[model samples]
Target: MLKLNYLFHNENLAEMIVKNWSYDPESTEMFRYYRISSNAIYPFRKDGRTQLLRFAPVQEKNKSNIEAELAFIKYLRENEYGVLVAVKSNRGEELAEIRTPWGVYYASAFVRVPGSAINQTDLADEIIFSHGHALGELHRLSSKYEPEPGAPRRWSYIDVLDWIDDQIKEYANAAIARSEVQLLREHFADLPVHTRNYGLIHYDFEYDNVFYDHEAKRCYAIDFDDAMYHWYAMDIEQALDSLQDCISEELYNHKKHCFLEGYRTAFDLPEDPDAVFPALRRFANLYSYARLLRSVAEKWDHEPEWMQHLRTKFEQSMRSKSTLFGTKLS
Candidate 1:
């Protein structure tokens, strides 16, 4: 825990909050504000009040992304049909000049929304419809909202293919790569079958970001960490397919149908949604395998030789005609 007295108005974590965090990790208990990243998040709870102090650094990678996320939250509150809320911290308070153990600290905050995050198994009828509707709403909002003059949001299907191809080249063990290549190639081939559209998007809406109250039968979205202007279709596909394991045929169909139905209710899906969905889903799966290959390789030291085994495992899975959803792909 880096001492951040000068940052938090000269207050430490214990001085700022009243909680039973004493039994928590010693490192967290040190700073009244613990930075989740060198310059991202610092979560502290006091008197049942939890606040995430966020900041952006000048020299940080995607430092400007902080601005984008904040802007997105502002947009969501105004237009989207969800219960999520954003907390506006003092401007430049996060980007303000402050000294710290990690260099400098920035500041931002969300409403400290509470609930269990969403999972695939939580896909009941109403929730499925809601997720679909949310996606559609997002697409509609993105289509109407304009980006900040200049944004990086024009990646193509070929570009996605290149990302997967490059990852496999960069880190794949030969045994794994060879087996996974067939499925990847098939997916890449299908990419040309669909066209892409650009729009403002909540590019990071994954299962964990969605809150599901199974009892109340309501759903909510949070965590605008990865929101950005992007291909709206790609963003939706990435969120739905990549984040949740759609392993059962019935469940996958139900989820996909509900997602589409809900989304269409809010905004217009493409005329060719059937084609668009599968192409995008294929790309996401290939991308996931690419990620798996690299993570296993880089973190090999942390997990022994399991790296090779996992790589091979995903490699073989890709070759199967059926997706995790149990649907056979063309």
Candidate 2:
């Protein structure tokens, strides 16, 4: 259920179901235009309070994996990790069942969260450095719990690298980036030796996945739906990559250094600071393949802009990795 959401939206139109969730006839309030993605996120009021509700469908195979995540978030929340206060529906169901155009989907909600998602400009020394500290705290606290085999944590670079190669080869029959895929494949074919293992990470850690208050110097990370096992070094790259994408060259380097300093203050590092680039470059390869498949799927859903932009971005990501190999990555 916590998997990438685009599929749910395409498989079943969730917006219509969300509209049905509202039993009120007033229809007086201006409903913000929200798309029905894999999840239905709606701005609603309960007892005069406004909040956001997010819901998704689950299958039998993934039920425990999803519930374990909710349980962990519950544990972390109790431990004062400062995560979302999950809003459960009637009868205290954190993961509830709801019938919809898509048959049935799981549902959960939360009070309207604060702060805008982070961007490059937000990587000023204060903002990003604080974010790094907060993330380090997250890794520190979350490391307290462990899963037997087969529990879902954030997805890692290694978990998806093989999957990426599979997908790129699948699209090898298309007009997509062949050379990029080749370079990616060449590196992936020999990745196991260079990869480092680390502690639990928010494998999906990215700037956009977190919220920040530049004024208060506070940051919050959301969407642990992809939380999984991986090296904390990967988490470092997750933070740095977002800054590099959002900010200018000069600020990017500065923010990255300070962010690393903050991270080290809270946790230990497994690899050299330079390791972040190669780690993320390898990560970017996997990201490209995922987006390419998603773009293809969305194109079938008539999202031309998303498809084309992802295609262009995929090539650009590959091009960006043209140098700095053998030394850092190999």
Candidate 3:
């Protein structure tokens, strides 16, 4: 989450950032302020289509990092992959760096993904298959992707583990957390890496970030914010885990089968995909735990009732996850 004070203090910041883009000034008032999480989002209308303006503080993201993300999107699009198309700014730049009183921010725009998020209650077998196929397609493209010389690249899974190690010191149980992260580092290092089994993957390939197009019977992915280089099976594991929240045990297995069946149609599954699930789950849990702790540490001035409630909820979640971090993570 961004600092609430910074966001509120700079009342005109969003407007200033919007000007860098090629959006209509008249529609500025109609631009709706979306939620702030990893990034601040604004949804606006243009030429009868909705578009999104996303900006993140320089401390959390830089121009190079944003460019690396866009490069991957461009590659996917060129390969006929169904991904969101990035819109260029007024100066024909994919990224705009704006200097504000609070801090520097990198802003970018994209055509809003068509269709809506998959409703967990209404998840269908075909949708599950489409979701799997989408991820497989992304992986297939990711395997052959290579950044041009001197271009920035997305961080690898090891980089994220190192980030977790650095972030652990700020937690209340830093020592214990450090040990768990160390164990994860060792475990990940031992995992075999072959071009066929590992590469960049859409780390957040679950239902929320994937928009389902009922008319085309296809799924389009969004939010590559968390994309990183890792075992392809980790993406499969994470997607399956998301179903646990909404469906029953029986249905979960059935859905899993359908998903894999669809996945195999696009890309071959590793010899033993399930073998990597445990470590991947631990990685996912710890990564989220560190992020949640950081969110709780930020201070808010006259925090809204809802924000306060969210903070308390995050704290409770952290407490529950804390126990699972040390010995269990090992």
Best by lDDT: 3
Off by over 4 Å in 1: 1-43, 53-60, 88-99, 103-107, 120-122, 148-197, 213-218, 242-247, 282-330
**TM-score for each prediction?**
0.59, 0.71, 0.93
> Every model's Cα RMSD, please?
8.3, 5.6, 2.1
Winner of 1 and 3 under TM-score: 3
lDDT of 2 by residue, 1-330 (tens): 122334333413434433434323232142453434334565556556665566666552245555777777776677776566677665567766677656576766666546777763435677777778877777777556665477555444455555455545655433333444445456545533322334456665688777786666677677776565565666777677777778778677777878877776666655565644564566554465455454443234554565456557655655555333223345
Q: Rank the candidates by lDDT, best first.
A: 3, 2, 1
Q: State in Å the error of residue 220, model 3.
A: 0.6
Q: Which residue pairs does candidate 3 place in steric collision?
A: none
Top-TM-score structure, candidate number: 3
Q: Which model, 2 or 3, shows the larger lDDT?
A: 3
lDDT at residue 322 of model 1 (Cα atoms):
24
Alpha-carbon deviation at 302 in model 1, angstroms: 8.6
List, residue by residue over 1-330, the lDDT tens digit for candidate 1.
Answer: 111122232334332221222223333443545533233455654344565545544443244565565555566667745646555433423223344544544444444565566674545667767766767776776666654677433343445455556656755343344344455556546443322255656655777667766666556677565454445676667666643473375567657777778777877676664566675565555555554444434332444354455446655765552244223455
